[model samples]
Target: MSSPEHKQLIWNLIKDIKVGMLVTKELNDEDGLRARPMSLVQDAYDGTLYFFTSKTDAKAFEIAQDKDVCLTFSNPKDNVYVSLTGKAKLSEKRDLIDQYWNKWVAAWFKNGKDDPDVAILEVKISKGEHWDSTNNKLVQLFEVTKSNIFESSTPNLGESKKFGTE
Candidate 1:
């Protein structure tokens, strides 16, 4: 079963959201962590994130040793933000790669889907949390007027070790 609040948070942050930063720690622990913007695939509900990648990429190598992964999605215009945690791995589904293939991809990868390096990076999300910049100005004003409503209106749905207000 999924909590309405948690499910809503995920939908709001991901359903129409296009891009996010996927950050992974290096297995060497030699100050080699990495973060890159990605065209996010849909959440599989089984707690995983799917990313377009290549077989020989450093990201895949990192996942090979350290499976843990975290992704961040933020809307600067709305001030809404989400942090997703999971484990990452490379997938061998050629059909899935061809599905996302397009002209733009052709421009970037030359031969496009035919590239031998192409692969999918899948992240199995264990949990996620969000901080939403409330959309209702009237509601915000009401909260300010009531003073205590600030704590009531904002919802923190995940138990990340660190929480942010902005």
Candidate 2:
């Protein structure tokens, strides 16, 4: 499919998930990587994703040093999983802050949206890949079992595709 079509499909799969794990390089950590749950702020999918973050947070610093980041979104019930890699930067744009402002986000800041620490983390996605299964759990299990019994082929788990700025 086309880039726009693939993006829309990804949005449809992940829009309800809301939260995704944002992974960034942590210079001080032993593993050299850190993953944190972040709430995605957007009504629809575009090429970019936004999240509210504290300007003083470690993630903000990490992104400053290395803009590359990865975001993972999953819905076990629907059997959809997506991974997106992108460049991230912090924005103090008041218009965006006001646009995505909500009570839930306000809880993170002491002075609500007016707080200096409140900042927007923008991730301009470069590439994204997703695995989606249309079958329910039972059917999926059956397929796996059938494949195992036959031992001639692998189970058809779902549709997997890589899309975006490739």
Candidate 3:
């Protein structure tokens, strides 16, 4: 698929998945990485993603120290998984913060959209990889079984593609 088409496919795969794992590298800890569950802002994906976060949150601090980050989304029932790498930064842009605000996000802040702690974590996605299994359970199981018995080949699960920045 074309780049635009691939991006749309990714959006379709993840649009319903409300939560994704946000992975960040801890400051001064080269070998340590932290991952936390975060909800997408659900506006639109135009090579970027947004999440609501507290400016004082550890993630915000980590992003300030190192912009590189990874995000992961999955749906076991559908057998779809995505991993995205990007650069992230914190923002207090009220207009943007208000645009993506909803009751669920507001619950995290005591003063609604006016809270000082409310911040927007913007991730400029550079590239991503995804695995999508399109076969039915029976077919998938058959493939797995066949592969196991054959002992030399792997199962033909589904489409696996890499998208974004070459």
Candidate 4:
């Protein structure tokens, strides 16, 4: 599929997931990588993902030193998973923050939109890959049994695709 089409498909699959695991490089730590759950700022995906974060948070500091980041979205019941690689930067754009703000966000920024600590993290995606599978229990059981009994062929586990430009 075309790049635009693939991006649209990815957006469709992940927009509803609402939350993703944001991975960033660890600073001065042996852990190497640190991942934390972040809520999506908007439902419409356009190769850029946004999240609200504290300006003083470790993630914000980490991204400042190394802009490269990864976001992973998954829905076990639907058997959909997506991993996106991107570059991120912190923004204190109040207008952008206001546009994405909702009641759920207010809980974190008790002082409302003017909260000094509130910041927006924008991730410009460079590439992504996704996995989708038919995870019905019956289908899986049959496939597993068939694969074991037949021993000549493997079951159709799922579809995986890589999309986006470098």
lDDT of each: 0.68, 0.91, 0.89, 0.89
Candidate 4 residues lying further than 4 Å off, grouped into runs, are 150-152
TM-score for each of the candidates = 0.70, 0.94, 0.94, 0.91
- Per-residue error for 125 in candidate 1, Å, reads 1.2
User: Model 2 segments beyond 4 Å from truth?
Assistant: 29-31
Model 3: lDDT to the true structure: 0.89
Instruction: List where candidate 1 sits over 4 angstroms from the true fold.
Output: 1-9, 30-32, 42-46, 135-166
Order the candidates by TM-score, highest first — what do you get?
3, 2, 4, 1
Clashes of each: 2, 0, 0, 0
- Pairs that collide in candidate 2 are none
Q: Which candidate comes out best when scored by TM-score?
A: 3
Error of 3 at 6 (Å): 2.0
Candidate 3 residue-wise lDDT, 92-165, digit = tens: 99889879999999889989999999999998888889999989899999999999999988999998988767
Model 3 / residue 142 / CA error / Å? 1.0
Candidate 2 Cα RMSD (Å)? 1.7
The pairs that clash in candidate 1 are: 47-125, 49-123
Give the deviation of candidate 1 from the true structure as CA RMSD.
Answer: 5.8
TM-score of 2: 0.94
lDDT tens digits, residues 1-166, model 2?
2378777887888789999999999967746999999998889877889999999999999998899999999999889999999999999999999999998898899799999899999998889899999999888999999999999989998999887676
- The C-alpha RMSD of each candidate to the native structure, in angstroms, is 5.8, 1.7, 1.7, 2.0
